[model samples]
Structure formats: C-alpha cells, structure tokens
Target chain A: MSESPSQPAQRRTALDALHRTLGATMTDFAGWDMPLRYASEREEHQAVRTRAGLFDLSHMGEITVTGPQAGEVLDYALVGHLSALAVGRARYTMICAADGGIVDDLIVYRLGDQEFMVVANASNAQVVLDAVTGRAARFDAAVRDDRDAYALLAVQGPESPGILKSLTDADLDGLKYYAGLPGTVAGVPALIARTGYTGEDGFELFVAPADAERLWQALTGAGADKGLVPCGLSCRDTLRLEAGMPLYGHELTTALTPFDAGLGRVVKFDKPGDFVGREALTAAAEKAAATPPRKLVGLVAQGRRVPRAGYPVTDASGAVVGEVTSGAPSPTLGVPIAMAYVDAALAAPGSAGVAVDIRGAQEPHEVVALPFYKRER
Target chain B: MSINPEQLRYSKEHEWLSAPEAGVATVGITSHAADALGDVVFVQLPEVGATVSAGETCGELESTKSVSDLYSPVSGEVTEVNQDVVDDPSLVNSAPFEGGWLFKVRESAEGADLLTAAEYDAFIAG
Candidate 1:
C-alpha cells in the first residue's frame, strides 16, 4: 500500500472515466493508463471462465495496409503466408527482422483484395508499423497507423457471441473464426472480428476512439442479459495464460527465433518464392530441423505458493535448469501453474519434476503439457 | 466490515490484535489488509510455535502480482495457525478479519501499541 511512484506517459482511453466510476486501480501498462483490476483478481478471473468478460483494448495498434500491392507487401514482411489470406479473413503472423528473430506477432486481417489491417500489441505497434511501412516501400503499398483513430474492445467468453449478436445484425455465425465483418451496433458503425486471446468464443470490436464509451455502454447494456462484465488486465493475463497464449515480452522476443516459440508453422518458406527473413528462416529452419532450441513447457507447482516470473527452476539434484516465464496461482485450476523454457530433451511430458525455490525453500513442481486449460470454443 | 473496536485493535501493517484474556494476545490480519493484497494464492505463514518479535517479519503472503509479508504486531509464539486460510487462502482476501485471518499469537507482552479504528484508517489512507 505504498504510493504508485511513477506517472504513466500514455494517454488514458475512453474507458478511463468508466474505470474511475467503477473504482478500478490504475497502473501504467505499456505507456497506457490501464486498470490492473476492478475488484478481486480471482473474482474477475472466475467471471471470465464461468461467464463473459469485456476488455478495453483501445491501446492496441491497428495498422491499415491498402494498396494494389498490399498483399505483396505483407507477404514480404510477415512469416505467415499473407498472400493466401482471402478477403475478410485474418491470420496470426509474426513480423520478423532479416536475422530470423521476430519483431512482433500480429493479426493480419485481409479486409479486401488490396486492403489488410494488422492488429499488433500496443507496446510494439510503432515497431511493427515501421517494419511494415519500410517493407511496403519496396512493393508499392501504403501503410496507415490507425492506433489513435480507433478503440478496440474484446467481448470474450462462452457467452460472448450470443450477447454480441443481440446488439448487431451482422450474422456473427457467418463470420467464421479468424474472420471479421463491418457492421453497426446501436447505430454505431464498428468492425466486429470473431477472434480473441481468451479460449472462448468471442468478438473483438474496433470502433472510433471518440465513440468508445458509448459503444462500451451499449454493448454492456445489450450484453446484460448474457452476463457480460468488464474485466481488466489482471484477469486478462490469467485467461491468456490458461489458453497458453504468449505475452510479448514474456515468451516472444526480438532475439528469440520463431522456431524457439513453437510458432515455426507461421514461417512459410514456399510462399511468394522469397520474403524478408526467408533465407534466415530457412537457415534457422534447417538448423532447427537438425537440433531444435530449448522448448517452452508448462509446469504445475506442487504447493499452493506459485512459482512467479523470474523464479529459477532446478532439477532433482538442485542443478539450475530454466527460468519461469509466466506463473500464477490459477484461479480456475485452484493450483499454481507456470510456463518455462527448458532443454528440448527435458521438455517431454512426465520426464521428471523440478523444484522452484519460492523464497529460500524448495517448492516441487512437475512439467505438464501446455495449455493448462482449454474449451472447445 | 464492522470495526470491532475493543475485540481487537489494528496496526499500520493492517494486522489486528485481540487482547488476550491474560498476557497472550491473539493476533490476525484485518479484512482490508487481505483485499489490499488481492487474491491470496499462497501464504508462507510462520511455523506453528515459531517465535516472533514485535514489528518483525513473521511470514509472507503471495498474491498473483506481488509478495508481501505479515508482521508480528506483538512478540509471541505462533500458538495456533489458521489452516482454513492455508488450504483455501483466498479466504484471507475475501474475509480477512474472520475466516481470512492468518494466525493466532500467544503474545510475549500483555499489550501491544494497537491503533484505534480512526488511526488505522488514517494510516491506510496516507
């Protein structure tokens, strides 16, 4: 209960007013004033699991690529086969440097034959934009940084689609997974995408920044019948962690190659003949095909004390092994869950258990297959 | 949420102490203390019967975001432990004063410098 020492440099979102009204504890996240949690983290977490949760994600960056060579430009920049993505479809892609290290992972949405909208994590938006626009110059395409103009809201959970459908006439069922549609909700034009980080059926709504509050209120009003509650970044972490989704700085890094992240499938060497990082990716792929890098694995801590981030993992003989990347006492699992990178040889399920020195004491843990939990939706 | 004025007094550390019938006061953390700590996932309570000195670190309470330690408001032996909080630790956060209480202490001194309701609230506010 010490005072928050630092002030956030980033501007507050349209939800800041609402957050204040709801008595949210604000924290500086990626330069943005974001709510850490509304009330209890576990309570917020349980709501998302058993019901629906809405997220204020206006800080995320949306880059619009529209030109005759838009697809060609993206095909050159991203690891995923962007050229094959049809209009109104979205695919998860990683933008990488020429050295085969990932610059950023983004969702590339093919809005038209020549228009692609790339949604990147808030912190890395500028970097992704620079890389995309820089590459676009070589292919005669245009890139627009649309971060300020729009706000993104995620309505995530098992009940999300049902609640969202009640507000709009845009046949949400027709919009397949990883697809999007432009429609109006409560007389407000919005772009609804059937995509989210939560391991539940949901929609990510992108709307005008000025209209963010109104859109949020409207959805909450419409979604009241379906039990939608506004969630914060605290629960967002647990939800994504349960789904085994990687946070930018935690799992993925500019130095870590795609193959190291179990996302090598995103690199399409055969697509478009050659692209940025193609040679490097092929080299890395060949290098990986022979001897892969250390793999990331999930661990279930034996005790109630969670193995937090930066905690060292040790073998049976007290030999320092890997480090814990993400960990928490999973509200859903009712136990401590963690993810760590270990030697590929030792990453197999049930190979052996390890101990995490929680403070000065050794807390035992076992390697488990990732995602700690999942739903069919 | 009732401020039990006489049953137990409070500390800036958010600990509460019920005056012992004799010299052994029973100490536990308050409900506000638990909510401020967020979801109580793991609590490293001092061993039962472990000696604790006043204004000293007793044990740790780890939440999803950070780790905080409970302080011994009065020097004593950890005569009794709260197993309910240890098993379902969130009880500490949900009901910090009652079922969420951390531990009971057999005080070394007859009395501790406990804060009144107004004092603890003002300390928390500042």
Candidate 2:
C-alpha cells in the first residue's frame, strides 16, 4: 500500500526503532528523521558534561578514498596536508570552493597507507562526495560514498572510558585523540575511534548498519552506572558550541572562508602541488594575518535574555556590527552565550561596548574567547 | 497542570484575567500557553499606568525555543506589573495562575470577547 502523501519523507537512521521506543522527541533534521531530545535538553546537556552521553551520529556522511593516490587526492581536495598524516591518525580540515569559500569542514581519518575516510556534515554530505569525486578525476584515487554502509555512534564525557572498557577488548587506553583503529567493540567488528565533537575524551564507533542497535544496547547496558544517557541533537549542539566547534551551517558556511572564521591554520599553504583555492586562500590568509576584516568571537550576555541566531550584534552607540550565528542558554555556564562574527577592531576578548539586540532591547554582553567550556583532562 | 479555574475569564490568546473588583483585574498567561512555551526564561511586561488595547501586543515572553508576543487581553490602564515572576520567569511555567501573574489592569471596559473556562478549554482543545 502507498503511504499517505502528507507523511514526511525523512531518512531514518539505523537506531530509529530504539529512539522511538525510548520516547525521543523526533524531528526532521537535514532530511534525516532524528531525535531532538530524549529528555529535558538541559538535563541531557548536563549529562554529557558531568558523566557520559551516547549519540547516534549515523546521519553524518562517511566517504572512503582508496588507491595509491588517496592522500594526494585529499591534499588536492581539502585545505590540509593529508599526505603526511600518519596512518590511523585524523585531521580536521575543510573543503573549499575555487574562490576560497568553505564548502564544508570535515574530519579525515587516515586508516592505512592508501585508505582514508572523510566524515562530512549531514547536510553537506552529498556535496562533499561530489566535490571529492570531481577533484579525484585527475588522480588515481577512487572516491566512494560509504554513508549508508555504516552506523556511527559516540560515547562521550569523563565516564566514557569506564563505560566502554567493559564492552571492548581493544586498547581503549592506548587510543589517542584524533585517532581511530579497526577493532572489535562489543563483539562487533567496528572502527573504534577516540574522537568526538563534544570536546571530551570519547570514542566514536563505526560499525555495519545492522550492528548498530546491538551496539547501542550493549553500550547502554554496560554504561548504566556511568550515567550514560541517550542524548539527541539538542545537547550535542550546545556541547559543540561550548567547545567552540564550528558547525557547517552555522559558524562555517559556503560564503565564508576558513580565514574569516579564525581557522586559517587548517589551510596548509605549504602543501605541495596546486590544491583547490590555494591562490585565493593564500591571499585571503595573508590579508587576514595582516588585518582581518572580521573575526568570530564568543559573547556572554549579562541577563537571561538569550541572543538567538540572526540577532544583530551592536557596538557602543548601537551601531550594527555583526550577527549572532549560534546561541543558547548555556546549561554548563548557567547563562546565555553566543558566537558571533564581529568587526576585527572589536574582536578581542573583553572589548568594550558589545551587545546583542534581543528583540528590540540591546542587552549588554562581554566579548570572550571561543570555547566557553572545556574538560579538565 | 492543565487547570482552568472556573471563575477566571480567558482570552483566545491564552491569557486569563480575574473578574474585575473595583475595576482592577489580575492578568496572567493560562496553563495552556505555559505548557506550549515549555520553560520561560524572561518576560517583559507593559509598564504600570500605560494604556493598553485588547488583542494588542504589549510585552514578550522569551523561552528557550523562541520569543513570543504577550497580547494584552483587555483594554485598560496597567495598574501593577508582577515583579516576582519577572525575577524568576519559570514561575510562568510552574504556577502560571498564582505567583506567575503578569500585570493588573484597571479595565475601562470588561473584555466582552473573553471566553468562559468551558469555552476556553474547548477552544484550546480544538
């Protein structure tokens, strides 16, 4: 029988049934039917900071680059030196257009000498795949979009190690940050990576789509005492925001280059051969180093009034300077914080006269450095 | 949590107003609006002595999700604005009818369009 026409045609993750049974508040996110929150967003945000939180990140795109020239192709496609990356290590990089605009920020994991996996944002997965494929036309590497073949899960926070120790025989202790290795986790063949977006010591397990539900069950069962709660996109957003991570659609967009986002370091101008956007990025980076036009900074509001996205950021005389990209009432800081792009002259932390136009009132705010919160470890 | 006191008059905008005594009425958002707004974080109320018209936007209710306009339910001059709820906005979500009252208005004319509790419940239900 045909489905009702009014029903939303959203792609379901492998853990869809599990989320539904847990009473998750389901919502459509980037064409994927995902959970917005399993409980109170504040409670979930606190759980990831204090204890541990499990996340179903299956919607994120995973692309595999293989062949002898894989690293070379990555070097050509992204703004990082991927060829020199040691095996099993990962690098945070970005794909840019020819004009030096950011296409998407990505995490490229060097699995082996000739194999690398690129993890792209959910909304930009297809674009990344097409860009990488087009960039590899002159190289010997073969780019394959392997998104549907894997289910990604993350166990994040201070209690992550203890919670995962009971489920895997892999050397969880030896796994370093920004690294991943193929290993058995919870008796399932998986790529156990010590990487996460939460700015906490954590593991991201990449396994076959069919093994996802089993892995989730095992992790929850093993982590029952470690305060492992099923977290949704809401807390994940705030956690990454606290960490000052740039989300693709928010902090990093196609119109803005890495240099404009205070991430010029990710662009390796010294890398050999002509990479995409090298000349423009070189000029942009040089200009930014000399005198940046604008800079992204953190803002902390005094009152409870939240400075939401698209809110205008103003100067002392109430002159519009920039705009807020991402904001929320910080569950960790117990106040409202935001990331905004402001004029370079006033980008320094504690700069005077920064305020967010919340509705009609200009709420006073203090400019601060990025990453509002960080783990002690 | 969805209590609609029988004695209180409600507006289609989900505000409740106490029956006028000496032309003064206590006004607040109903439980239905509170539940819809989830957790209230901030509230901006009309200044005392400011004249207000029924069904007009006078203040705002900021929640975590988004900001919404608080419509004045009756035409009158504002008498008292609730400072207690303004100090702690969650009262709007907790005790929306009691400690969470927004402002009092001395009515020039009773809100003829205000609904009875039964009608208000039916309106929200629909």
Candidate 3:
C-alpha cells in the first residue's frame, strides 16, 4: 500500500526480497518496511529463548566517528566515557540534550584506537547524526552517516555460539562479551560482535550491504541443524522487553533523562572534559538519589489479561500512579510482563496495591524486579 | 488457509456465524481476522446471558502484537462461551473455525446483511 504523495515512502532493507520469499508479514516500523513475523510471533520468540533465532537488523542506524579525537568527541557528545573504552570493545551509552533529556540509547563500538561506530535506533538516526556532528564541530574528528553502508544481522539464543562457530574463523570463544573483531564469515568480510538485544549469547555481524544476502544464506544453511529460525521485529520487541532493555522511543525519549529511566549508570559524571547535559544530569542524579520524581519498575500481570503500552497503572484507590511503557505476553514466562514508570514512592519491587487498567477492567499486576527472563550463563 | 464454509454467514467485521438451529448459532472470528491478529494471547467473550447488539463491540482479542475489538454480528444473548479457546487462545490462530469458536448466542434479531461464503471471500479479497 502506498502512502499519500505528501508522505515519504518507507525504506526497505537489503533482505526485503528474501523476507518476502519466506512469506513474512511485513509492517511499517520507524519508516522501514520490515518483517513483523515469518510464521508465528510466539513461535519466533520461543525460538530465540530456547534454540536460536536470526534477525535482519539492517534497519538500525550506524554512524561512524573517525580521527585522532574520535573517542574524545564521543565523550563530549554522549553521556558515556567512551574515551576510556579499550579497542575492539563496545559500551552501552546514551546521548542527551542540554536539558538532560535523552536523545537516544546507543551502543558505541571502538573499532580502533582512532575510530568508533555508534549504533542508534532506526527512527532517530538522523537526529543522532545531527547532534553528534554539531557536538564534534571543534574536535579533530569527522562524523559520517554509515547507515546505508552496512547490513547488520544477529544470531541469538543458547545455540548461537555453535551455529556461528561453524561459519566464522574469528575467535568466537575468545571474543568476550561486548567485543567485536574484523573477520571473514562464510567468505564475506564482517565485523562480528558478541553482542545482541535478545538477552542471549550471540553475535551481531555487520557486513557490506552487497554481501547481506549471501551471508544470510550461509548463516541459515549453517544454523539449520542447530535449530536456528529467521526471526522478525515482533519477536525482537518481546525479547528485548523480557531482557528489560529500554527501547529508544518507549523507555527513552526526549522528554525523559537517562536517570529518569533508571539508566543513570550509563552517564559518567567524572569524565575529563565538559559534556552535553552534564550539569543538568549531575543535578538530576543527585535528585534521583534523594527524591526522584518517577521510577521505572517491572510489572507482572497477576491475571491472564495482557497489559499493553499506554495503559494506565493504578494504585489501590484507583488513582493513576504510573503508565506502562512496554508490555507483552511473555512467551518464555507464559505470563504478561510490562515495564512502567510509576511514582517513586511505589516503585519498589513487591510494593503492594498495583494494577493495570486494561480497558475498563482493573487487571491485578505485581511489581517485581526487572528482566522477567534471564538466560543462564 | 481454510476456506470459509459455504454453510456459514459472514459479517463485515470478520465474524462468521453458523446457520441458527432453534434460534441459537455458533460464532467465531473468520480465519482472515485470526491471521491478521497473530498469536492470540487472550480472548474476552461476552458473559453468558449478556445481551450484545449487532455491530457493537462485545469483547476483545489481545494478540502478542496488538489488540482488536470483537464485534457481535447479530443482536443476541450470549448463551455460552468457549472456555477452551479462552484457556488456549492460540487455538484462534490454529483452528479458527472449529475448536476456536468463540461463543454461542440465542439470536433475538437478525442483522439482515450477513454475506454468503462467496460474498465474504470477495469482500476480503477486495
């Protein structure tokens, strides 16, 4: 279906034709025409939790910062102390506006001592590029939009190691978590990083767009016996939600700070030089320690009814105390789980009297610790 | 996908109704609707003895990805709801016509606009 002439067209990934051949149901996500599911969302989700699931993550944004001061520029542009990160390692960080509001949660990979790659959300790619580019105006580094240059794919689950080991010569065993190494996988050049959003032991391969189809076929062929299935974005949402990872638009937004989302640990206050949002975030951090306004907490439904995003969370007296940010029927847990921003006083896990207003009905939900499911290491 | 049974009548809201026997009929969501709502996690049917007006929302079907309104195709009193489908909502996706039949209703009034199987097929195709 085409949009009106005034609306921009949705972008497709390198694997668009392949996804169609596999009978995937496509949906518009963040201006990208991406696969929502291949067969069943629950089955896809369970595959990632039990066996292995492969994902086409080419829709994610990749921005490159290079030069002598690349790391320094990141330190000032984003909240994390990226300059301290060792080569070949990645750090989960965020970029915030001057008002202490988060721009986007990112993963910064230090490819070399003088080069770094910042992975951003699909919807906020341009926003991140603009922010970082402006912040790097005085630094000796150059920022470039590399979104279209790479096709990213991930194989995640318990069997991921075995599945990937068969195709790559890279030291998958020695590649510690959050580490990436340049290598050839199935005769194609790739950056294999032992990082994923599925809360599993996995590898994310960043390869040239031209080689995506071949790489995908090789991975599919190699992973077939290991029980790997091609997954879609629908399952990816549930997987990340179960892992308690905050999505950029949902848990993080320009209206909320990393501190507000309970991600203040990503913001380093003791960095060598001044950084954006430092002053505001420093005060926000102090306020959070003393008396935070709202706190994010995990909510597990006590009933079979699913609690959905934007549903109001109420207290014992039926007063709105919070709002759900992300929620889904957890395939692994077999119950509805959610993440919500509740009033600070009632944010503690196991706090009494919490429920989600599902339509007109008040479905009971228990406040619990986050990460509804954690894979055993 | 299973074709809509010729003996059944369909509504534009994607509900299928079996021919009423003694003023009571079986109702379920069409396979087309079930396919659109992936991996149904929960189904809320109108309670037994509750009156549902035609073309009005009676309940909800919550899938993993979204929630959809379940509309009553005819004005009737819900006589029985399928607890089997409620207990295992995935049945809606697996067997929408048979095991996943949502509810039974004692028809009080007909909508006068139910489509035949062929008409329903053409409607969805369009």
What is each predicted model's overall lDDT from 0 to 1?
A: 0.83, 0.90, 0.93
Error of 1 at A169 (Å): 0.8
Q: What tier of docking accuracy does candidate 2 attain?
A: acceptable
lDDT of 2 by residue, A1-377 (tens): 57689975889999999999998877788889998888666777788889999999999999999999999999999999999999989999999999999999999999999999999999999999999999999999899989999999999998999988898888888889999989988899999999999888899999999999999999999989888999988788889988998888889998888999899999998998889999899888888888877789999999878898899999999999999999987878978889999998888999999999988899999999988988897
Displacement of residue A229 (Cα, Å) in model 3 is 0.7
Write the residue-wise lDDT of candidate 3 on A183-207 in tens digits: 9999999999999998888999999
Pairs that collide in candidate 3 are none
State the DockQ, from 0 to 1, for candidate 2: 0.39
Leading candidate by lDDT: 3
lDDT of 1 by residue, A39-133 (tens): 88777777778778888988889999988888888888888888789888989889999999888889988888888899999889999999888
Instruction: For residues B4-103, write the lDDT of model 3, one tens digit per residue.
Output: 9999999999999998998999999998999888899999899999999888899999899788999888898999999999999989999999999999
Best by TM-score: 3
What DockQ was computed for model 1? Answer: 0.69
The residue-by-residue lDDT of candidate 2 on B1-120, one tens digit each, is 337999999999899999889989989999889866656778989999999888899998976556789988899999999999988888998899999999999998766799989999
Determine which window of 10 residues in candidate 2 chain A has minimal summed lDDT: A36-45
Better of 2 and 3 by DockQ: 3
The Cα error of candidate 3 at residue A33, in Å, is 0.5
Clash counts per candidate, in order, are 0, 0, 0
